[model samples]
Target: MSMQTPKQLGGISFGLMDPETYRDMSATKVITADTYDDDGYPIDMGLMDPRLGVIDPGLECKTCGQHSGSCNGHFGHIELAAPVIHVGFTKLIRRLLRSTCRECGRLALTEYEREEFRERLQRAKDLGEDPNDVLKSAVRQARKASNCPHCGEQQADIKHEKPTTYYEVQDVLSGEYSEQIAAAMQPDEDDPDDEGTSPSELASQSGIPLDRINEIVAGEFRPRTEDRKALESALDIDLTEEDMNKLMASDIRDWFEDIPDDDLGVLGIDGEISRPEWMVMTVLPVPPVTAVRRSPSITAA
Candidate 1:
């Protein structure tokens, strides 16, 4: 029994449940929806497993060996057939997803900017100054960049549907960049500005480099290798040209599955936050046996 009133009681904090926490609290492995047998007895190993505790008076709880009202209801869990996004953290998820690059899965902030922000944060810590405002401002600035500096991929505007679903404005490769590549591939001799002079023809004709022209001609687009390598290490994948090609065709949902643990921690996830794609309802804690016991239905005379 708690001494504090409902208003004074500190509520439980909801967070991702690690396996250890889940298993320690669970009283029985619930497999079926049926709670009781034909005789109205709690079916063993069912949703109302006796191991969860005796819900009736005069019957001792199998777990705590206490009768109803004396024993608190034990915890039992339901393994979801599929994961659903946690409703509470929807905003956090949306912000983090938008702020991170889809291609490299890194924060939008460039390396130099990241270092500068980190140094400021460190200085603040050393000086015993509250860094909340500084950190917020830094994160805000980082999230404003429309393009990922590392991958050179323009970020799409994220639109979140009420409750759970999220969508983004995806760009077709053939739309904007294709025109630029086409412009780059146009011959210098063909350009009206080029006089076919004795001077530096290449420099005068087009400011774009020869290698860049070759890339356009070859129809080869390489993502920033530096960030790709870092992402590969985080995802534990080789990410060869072939892999990247395959990924280019896949949906963004697939990409979310490989986000690293460190990134999740930065997003305020504490422990073992694997695969941001689905929010797993891993553990379900049952109330005390006393809490589960229901009063008899009163019939009108």
Candidate 2:
């Protein structure tokens, strides 16, 4: 009978749901197995996650211009099974995305699924079931996959920024493009004909321009952003500044991205892919009290 403020729901003192609990308690429903596709196939792929309310209908959202983030739905439906997930409390249907098509349109969650999931979630709560497992399942299923709908460029939603010297640089260079970029930045012209090499490969090999191959093949490396135009001419390959920026924008800086799931080496970059620095820093009596780097592996190691 007493009203509790939304602000008082959680802080340092009490860890609880938002003060809008009564509002959220409205009936939420889960997508039943009966849900079907245009072909009469189960839209859920038979692997139903209770947490996921609906699958994303992979289509372009005309309103938002991009299909990745929240938007007021307004778009022509593409004949696609757009799987989506609905958050219980808010009944927010987040689209489950893969690689988005920049040329076509963005992803969108179905409103129908949102309402359905909310009802099911309310019922689950009333039954005194824990919401933790459902929440976790939802997280894994709902991976963030977004891109620029206009330029057809990949979205830089998740950034992998790193700072370091030797090993770290080498690690970053382990990616397919990273190695190509490193090789391109400093080309070896005197090494005779690079049989399968292309202007693009050359662009990646020396981190310079394919057009500037001759010049860069004999010159020092420059900053990634600046001096690209000059370098392009040196390579004599007609490489553009936009090309360099696209490569730079990619997750080429992440070595772990390319690393395979094994305890051993990846393609020849030998070593147990863990923190070698831990033993390096901790073992020495007067350990180097330098700035510590926090990578996913470092902390886990």
Candidate 3:
């Protein structure tokens, strides 16, 4: 067999792997979590599956049929127990979540606004200025929009929790009223006869029945205690259990790819680039076998 000289590379490309990409690259489905056995041998069907080629000289590599240093490492994959956000794209996730609407999953900008901003960005580019400056301005404006221009639903504030979690800042005002709240904002001053005017008399003055005003003053607006308890209990579903439901990597890839070009452009990403949501790591790439294998050190005799 004749060997061909390697062509000189012009540039290297890096990208997120969709599920199909992951499947195509993987040599085996790693069913066992173990990497090596007690004797340091690669465990069968484990993370260091032999189908992923071999690192030890004693065993023949399954894929390349080479021993030890002669074989290049092949990739094998283990299905994740749960989805995790990709650490690399934390900032991108925050930026995308904040700029897009939760309800409609669309950018907060109106069609007209996006067009205008697009023009501004292009003009800036033409003028030999940084288009990113214009993009940032548009993003700033979009972030302030509270409602989705497409859906008309209110947009909740997107918050980034520590260690790669995204949360919506839904400030649900408690409907329950406590006596402490009433006492904090006392409505009445000194009335000579502590028992203020009868509901009828107050009603006469305001044209609204004094009884109604009394109900308002006495905090009738507060939800009854039993009702509040029921509500609290009803909303107490376990979030951890909900998170256990696995989302397929392919579906997630589609979601990232589905974000409109204009929306991604506003976030300073061109259509050719992956969306910020791709930061959520669906597939993990394994290093080359040669990279992981420890090379023997030569010592001077």
Best by TM-score: 3
- By TM-score rank, best first, the candidates go 3, 1, 2
| Tens-digit lDDT string for candidate 1 (1-301) | 5797556656766555554566678887677767667766677766566677766546666677777666666877666565546677677667766777877777778777766776777677799998766566665866788888777887765667777667766533332332443443344776778543221333234444556534533457442445334323433434342111111112444555555555444443443544455443444555443454452211111
Per-residue alpha-carbon lDDT of candidate 3 for residues 18-132, written as tens digits (9 for 90 to 100): 6556668888777766667776667777766677777665878888888877777788766666556777776766677667775556778988998888788778878998887
C-alpha RMSD of candidate 2:
26.5
Off by over 4 Å in 3: 1-10, 37-41, 123-131, 176-258, 271-273, 295-301
**CA lDDT scores, all candidates in order:** 0.57, 0.30, 0.62
Off by over 4 Å in 2: 1-113, 147-196, 200-301
lDDT of 2 by residue, 1-301 (tens): 7798666445453222221332233112223334345553323322121111212234333323433233332211111132111112111111111211223322211234334444545565789986545443332322233433334444322212232111111111112333333455453677655444555665674465555644444443333433444443444433332211122211221322332222111111123433111111111111010112112222334
TM-score (C-alpha) between model 3 and the true structure? 0.69
Task: Give candidate 3's whole-model lDDT.
Answer: 0.62
| Winner by TM-score between candidate 2 and candidate 1 | 1
At residue 139, give the lDDT of candidate 1: 57
lDDT for 19 (candidate 3): 53
Residue 133, model 3: Cα distance from true site in angstroms:
2.8
Task: State the displacement of the C-alpha of residue 141, model 3, in Å, after optimal TM-score superposition.
Answer: 1.1
